[model samples]
Target: MIKQIDKSNNLPSKISTISSIRMIFSYALLKKKEFILMLLFMGLGITFMMISPQISRRVINILENNDSNTSVNDILLPIGLGVLISLVGAIVLGIGRYFSAIVGTEAQYNIRKSVYNAINRQTFSFFNKAETGDLVARATSDIEMTTPVFNQGITLGFQSIIMMIGVVVGISITFPSISWIILLAVGLFLLAISFCAKRMQIAYVKSRKTFGNLTTVFRENIIGAQVVRIFNSQEKEIKKFRKENADFKDYTIEAIKWSTILRYSGWIMLAVMSSFVLIIGGWQAYVAYQNQDLSFDLGRFIAMLMYISMLGMPINQVNNVVMNFVQANAAMIRVKEVLDAMPEIMEDTNAISAENIRGDVEFRNVNFGYTSTLVLKNINLKVEAGTTIALLGTTGSGKSTLISLLPRFYDVVNGELLIDGVNIKKYKIEELRKQIAVCSQNIFLFNISIADNIRYGRPDASMNEVIQAA
Candidate 1:
């Protein structure tokens, strides 16, 4: 059986939702100019959209009056202006979307780069407990999910809030009595939002975790294909994979169910508010007409209805934005876990850098364990320069562990490991590693030229040197 390392000990402290969101915003700061430009364009688009309804109201009022003094230009001018504003708004919104895409791509790249570097920095013990497939999922699927949170979730969410505010203000100014109706509808919408958001968050997090587990199952099966074939365990592996796959599907379905309900509920609420506004506004308009009050005419009533519809669009979008935020929050948590991990081994500021080391190694009273059980105990060993030695042991023996200590793949818990008469920890990790190498029992070769493989340790090596090493 393969020895299992305690993963809990290796994992970093869990990051809270607020902290994860803060980190995402900090990452966005890397492309602050692009993000700001996108926001400005979104604001411009919303401003134009808010102005369109007023133009429509004016057109209706002019046509309703049917004044003999009015020319075609009187109606045509506002109609043309409304179209122009809409066209300009579409163009500006498109530009904003383009910038948002660029910003999202750049942010994703930066995050992946940071995560890759952080993973690389971890010691072997960290990888011993980590799954290759889970890491792959985080770097790819997780990053992809997170991009929309920054671009669509935050940016469009801000736009939605601004638009909603503008709609409320416009309605308040145009029809004060019915403005309370809009506010009441919005208040109820918020209550529904809070309840749905909590449930969606739980479902999304579970879904992401299940997906990671499924990826791990697939990855391990592929990597160990030969072993499985030899043992004729294909059926067993398939059964295990199916179980994980089913769990992933179930979790995903649960998440979709909640999100779907939230989305449809938003539409339902908007529809009800729209219908209520229409009924009340129509009654008030009829009353004003009866009283010869021209202010609350059909034109203003129609504009108020249009404004309510406009408000609904953004309110409806809140569901999508919340969904994205929940997924991004989960992905960010996974990513931040890796980034915040403390490497088991760290170089001291005062560590020395050495050159031209003699090949002398020593282990004194070494005691080590991956867990509670010690694998190496009070071991003493020494090898002189230019000497050859062999460590022979059975499958569960500590042979690999013994050799691994020379390069500090792991540090001894209670002893000193030395090279060339100085403690290995005294030497800069990179400088110390440069002078030693181990050809493992299970070798892995890259899909590159033989010359490149030979030069893997020293990319700056000349062709002649690579040939010599080969």
Candidate 2:
């Protein structure tokens, strides 16, 4: 599971656009109540933000137009109102984030559960192809990568857009002519971000591939630790570990490098944009003062500066989300592959349940192979109820392979296998497997009492039966 962290650092590689991330998040956060709560709080916060500039301008104007006729209560009243509004905004923002986290946690839980359940249902053949460590990575690390997408992506993504739009609206309503420069700067910044986002996606994919390879190595070393010790190959294993570790480090550094570039680039863009605003704002302020026109109020100019200043946080947040999505894309792809898989074995139409069984089994003229080479050829066998048949074969002579075939571990390539005269494929897999009891040379033991391990064969078997099996 620790291996997922290495892969997680490579998350941003998969997402192509912010919209893609948003859509993915929406699907993940399926619960309506959680979604509504998150949105409600989010709306409150952004609404407060949009109105904040106007309130600040109001306060400034009150202070500027001081007169004996106007009581001190007039200024104090607006100041108090602004402060109260800000307080409510802060509270709403806090609540919104808290609920967003809850939604994300629940959403990730469902995703992880589904991934684990799907993997568990897969046949032994599936494990033969998929690494145990990779499964762990998907369930743990991959599921975790979706958390931010569920939480921040929806709430923060929307809030950023609202804030940007709200600021633009304020500027347009107040000073129509100067609003063009602000809009233009925002558009240019978005274009640059989009270009960098493309490169981030590419880097993110490479990082995920590297992480998968790294996870494979980690899993192999752990599972085969005893084998390495017995063979006196500790040095070899260590060297291999070092190589994988180095590769993981390199990929992680590459991922972080791109995120860093995006983050800093956004900051620099905002800085440049701010400089432009200052130059233009200062010019406008100067012109209004020289012309003795009340069009450009000092109060409104100061408020505009504050609004643009506040835009910095949302801009940075947007950039951060883009980078996070890049790293998470690998997780999404891995998870999607599992979700989209078509099971090799599926129940036949019109399948019926049997109420009784005598445990008679037959394999007639069955030919089978695993992957490339043939393992069973022209095999014919029958086992009646209560029959004790001894299977004797040389190593790799298909004793284990033949036993495996009985449970349909690997289906026969040709011919028929029947249990109680019905074709094995026609019977439900679980029903067929339940009738057989297998005791191999290698017995699997869970982390439980000896009695429990025996009971695993027959989950509802009596204590006496379990003891007898052991």
Candidate 3:
């Protein structure tokens, strides 16, 4: 399915965005060496492409000479060489395609791994600020946007450019007098393309971002189905979904509309180019005949025409790659946003491991809040080993807030918290959390068997132990 991500409004800083994309592409290329091989094959195929046209010109000259010195073998030899080059080109192109696909898959795998690692290391605050659906989109959907760009765009896309250059250069060198017609047509097409492409790179990028936002909404609603159902907010959710869907549709339509225009416009340019080249070449051939320098090789013209026509495919591929890069550039911006984020909670590099310690906890004039809203007040408290202190308060009375401080979920606003006569912040977060477990009234089961739930506390627990806990 042609999933459209409409996000033409949220484009990021270009330098950072392009840097992120380059880094990913470079890494993916390294991981999949076959892509490099495919690139080499593409180069070979293009060289063959250039040779086909020249061979045609050669064959034409041979056949047209028809002098007593010329023989069928003369014509046959170049024809055979052209066919051989063509055969080799076809085989190499197939190999290049195979390698490209393999490399693309490998690149996707590496990108997914990098995104997964970044998501895993993200702090709770980051998650709270980011949508679950958005994160999932980055790991799954966004990575998908990059696959084609890496495989075809990074490898064959450049090869196609080289191929186009080879065709142009080959034609210019062989038939310089009439080449200007082709060049003129090319210049006009490029001008039209440049005008069409002016805002498209930016537009497609914006569209992709909108799609990400839409995916985030879809992800959140689906994952939080229970909340939506319990609240009976189906209508509200549907309305929101429809809105996002409409926005995506609009942006996608715009991108496709322009892209289609550019594509057809390019095709028109190619057609005009062909007619121009044919007319000018035909005239030149006539002039050469009058000057006794034109021995027309219809075979060479046919071959040259074929070579010129082949340019169309790579041109299309190049355009597609440009669009792909722009779209991936968008995804890269979103992905980098996560990778570049610095966690709010600080970690201790010099933390020490202390065993055989009592779990003594204390709070001294602690004050806390979420943003500007104070959730806790300045207060003093202490808890020694083996102490049983109950928090008595009505709902929203800061009991949960106070207890949360014990684990350093939120650092005190104006005071200090100590555990084992040491500042809680001094200990590594994981080490500190390991010493305490809060069994909430609402348990989150993993949809696994009962044994698994008990085993969650101790993954290495014995079956007997799990059974006993259950």
Candidate 4:
């Protein structure tokens, strides 16, 4: 089965150049020698790219001379050289892509693992604030969005920049007269791209955000299918999903419009610039032909045109890199949000660890609340060892919140909670939780054998023990 991530709307947050560069290098997770080699191969591949146009120019010049004295070998020599250069370029570029693929895949794995671990360490309260579906999207789809962008967009994007520089230098050395036209057109293209890109990015962000909402809707519908049927509100749920899906489509179309404008405008500028250069070069060649100077000849004019074409060659690729970069940055930000989360409950370094806990629980003048408005207040309670106690309260009366305190999920805002006359704060968080057994109201069963599920919390328990527990 092939899985495809629809990242059309899965776009980016702001990508600050410096921070993003730093993040890229860090997340790339390549060893120094390997990273250096990847860059070397990409550079060598770009160097070979520069040679092809020059070879074409040389071959054109030789052919244009129209001299009987020029041998067949002379014509074949540059053509042969061009073919050889192409072969070498292919090898180095292939090697570069190979290295990029490995690194990209590895980086994606590390990020996914890190995000999963982060989510696991979070307090139960964290999930109440963050959408479970959005977090899932960040781990899967968002993490996935960065891999290809890194491999194709970032790696090739680097080479594209180098190629652009090569084109500039090649033009300056070979045809300085028309270099300004290429340069001017390029300048305008950049300015125009910059002006429009912000809106494009925003649209992409909206699109991806809607997709996250879509995921949430799907998850809720599936998980709450029983409740939906019980209420006979399946149609309402379907409508909600459709509305979110439509919003995603609309946002994606808006993003496509912006990207299309940027992409096609580049080609248009290249066309206009090529024409302008040709007209000016034609005028110069005509004067030279009339004067019989033979300085600005057909060969040089043809070479100039080839140089212009080469300059425009990488524009499409560079544009693609730019779009990929924006999408990846958006993903990076969401993933970063997960990595940056600090668990509300923390284990204290100096806390004591108990191998065995005596069952004596007391809440002394406890006052607690998720916020300033207290859900629990001024409580005094004790439950002795081997005694069974029940907490009976009306809804919103903090029954669940009070039980949650036993595991140190949230600390009381005031007063002490004691286990065996020892303040719970002094107990190691792990040791404290291990001493208690909790069965949540919303239960989940792992898809495993009954015996396995019975001993999940105590994997060492024998089958006899598992049967007894079950």
Candidate 5:
């Protein structure tokens, strides 16, 4: 039962990045109103932030130009106004973040529900082929990954872009001469970040894949612990688990390495750009001071420096935003894979619902297989109602396969399986299954009372009914 699948072969193939992103965000579209409100609040916050820098310049100008005619109120008023705007900005930003978080959380919740429902609808053959641990990972970790992308990535990323644009416009108006230098720094920063982001994306995908494999290995070991102990193969199982754990560690380290490079490179670029702005702007201010130019002064130079620093903030966020995008993309692909999987058995839309079902069953010229290798050949059988029957065979015989077909666990490839003289396919699958109960050879008693376990199929059954059934 501890079968291994080729994890590499199961890794999601890289699809169009834009298409993946669009599909992921489609879930968020349900909360578009919240998202829009978040943006509006964010815009207000950014507006205040942008205005504060200009107010800072005015306050500096007032202080520097202090004279007999200058009033104390002039400096105090602008400084107070800047502080007030900043406080309001903080409040607005908090509100924006709250709304964004709501949207993100709701989107994640919806996606999780959809995935769970989709998984539940899948036929038994799907579970046979899919790794239980891998499916669990997709439902948990993969869905979690998409949340931050919706919460911080999209909202903060857009805010960063808006802030950058506003800063650029302010800089160009205030210090037209030095604006191109700021643009050049920004362009270089983006180019470097993009290159590193691509590498990080690859690493993140590998890391996610290895994590799924590790989860699968760990789950298999846990479920098969009794088998390992019975065979005294604990050492072998431990070695196998360790190998998968090591692979996961290696992949995680690789992804972290790339992310580190991306972050530090952005920091280095910011440092260089800040130094460039200070030296060049400081030199120009000094020259203007010597020339007694009224156009360029200490206040304007300070404001320009502040604007350059503002540019660095978004540049710094580039790595974080890109990393979130990449991780979300990878997770979305896995989630989509599960959602897109086609169930091997599908109930007909016009399926008949038999009101009263008899226990009689028939198989006519049936053929079945797990894959290409047939496990059951053309055979006909009839089981009369209320008749006691026993199927005895050695291991690998069609006993389990034959009984599994009675419940339509696997549909016949070439013939009909009928129940009460009607093809089982014509019956609603749920209704058909409700009439049959299976007690597998490998009994799995849940951690509950025996009475509760017996009543599991019909919880509404009374205690008397449970006792009678027992």
Candidate 6:
């Protein structure tokens, strides 16, 4: 059995978005050094991008104030420095992306592994209620959705904020009078992003659910193809699939619609920023020039334009980050639902060890059910050591359910099942299971060699034992 993490209380299906994101980060940050290195590289890369613009502004300023005191080297120096820093930004971004990929891949691997372990620990009732296809989608596609946060979502969001602050600060220091206008535009831009985030989250949640349903429908058709062929219902199955496919498409389009809104928000912010600089800031700078004040000049006004142009990249990046994170949060909710289900059988913490066993078994007034209604009721049976008994029953008569009780697959609800005269639940579950084996009615074979398949329940079985069993 996989060792389960007991720290986080398995929250319900309605788990909060921030909590889901926090859970995701817990998985991603497992490799401490890798996460730290990724942040370090990301900070360095964005720093270069930020400084380059400021240096380019200095070049424009030097040329605007050109005089006998200003040399050619003064003109060439800031220009060269700006270009050099831009190149460095590109290189640092490459390294940062490499580390981000490593962290993202590691996170995906860890989450997949943990989710698989959680599934293995689930009881038989879990499979009875869960669609195979829906579970498969959650384990694969939904988990894949969480990965973009590490890849582009986190870095892009951080970069966007840093750049926004840089632009506002640059604008404030250069043209302080109209800095408030720039701040207001940025504030509006953030409000638009926040509005879009709520819409995207709703759309993503619906889309992921519809996709799971669609997957379930498709998997059912494929797995039951023989039944469909026997009943000549292929057309009916195809029609059902098409309906589900349409639902998936509609929900996906809804999500895309919200993403488009976010993209347009960035564009709208850019337009507003440009208008403020070219129109409002222009008037302020003219007044300053008329007053013969050197605090704000035409070159500095041009620098404000440069900052406006630079703000576009972070705006677009923020759009992507919001979309990625909101979608990822929706996916995380689906994944968390699987981990939150309660199993029927929990091994007793104070159970006795099951060592060498006599083959005696007994079921005493046993009443059991997978749900509220009992499938097996008021049953009493006993078998002595070295004796065998056959269970004779019609279909749906609980014969399989009775046999399933011995292995504790589903615990008996209202009676005692004993092995060797001691209550089975009193024995340590692992050791108790190791003492008994049953050949189930449902015949399922794994994709492996025949000998391996024969000895699957006992992987340590020798070749002779496997051959004899086969």
Root-mean-square deviation of every model: 3.5, 3.7, 3.7, 4.3, 2.7, 4.1
Where's the lowest-lDDT run of ten residues in candidate 6?
Answer: 1-10
Kindly give the stretch of ten consecutive residues in candidate 3 with the minimal lDDT sum. 1-10
Those runs of model 3 whose alpha carbons end farther than 4 Å from true positions after fitting are 1-11, 32-35, 181-198, 219-232, 287-304
Across residues 1-470, which tens digit of lDDT does each residue of candidate 3 receive? 01233333444566766697787667667655686788888888878867877777777666566688887788799889989999999898888877887877787777778778877766555766676666667677777878777667777676777877786776677666667766776677678666655456566666656676788778778778999999999999999988878877876777777778777877887888888878877886788778977555565566667767877986787678766776677677667666666666666788755344588888888888766778787788888989998989898788877877766666777889888888877887777777887766556889988888889868899999988776
Cand. 6 Cα-lDDT: 0.81
**How many pairs collide in each candidate, listed in order?**
0, 9, 11, 2, 0, 0
Which is better, 1 or 6, measured by lDDT? 1
lDDT of 6 by residue, 406-438 (tens): 988888899899988998988888888887888
Every model's TM-score: 0.93, 0.90, 0.89, 0.91, 0.93, 0.92
Per-residue lDDT for 96 in model 2?
A: 86
Cα lDDT over the full model 3: 0.74
Residue 138 error for model 4, in Å?
1.8
The list of candidate 5 runs beyond 4 A from truth reads 1-16
Candidate that beats the other on TM-score, 3 or 4, i.e. the better one? 4
TM-score of 4: 0.91
Give all candidates' CA lDDT scores.
0.82, 0.74, 0.74, 0.79, 0.82, 0.81
Model 4 agreement with the true structure over 126-210: per-residue lDDT tens digits: 8877777877887888777787676777677878788878887887777887788878988998886786577677776666677
User: Model 1: runs farther than 4 Å from truth?
Assistant: 1-15, 289-295, 462-468
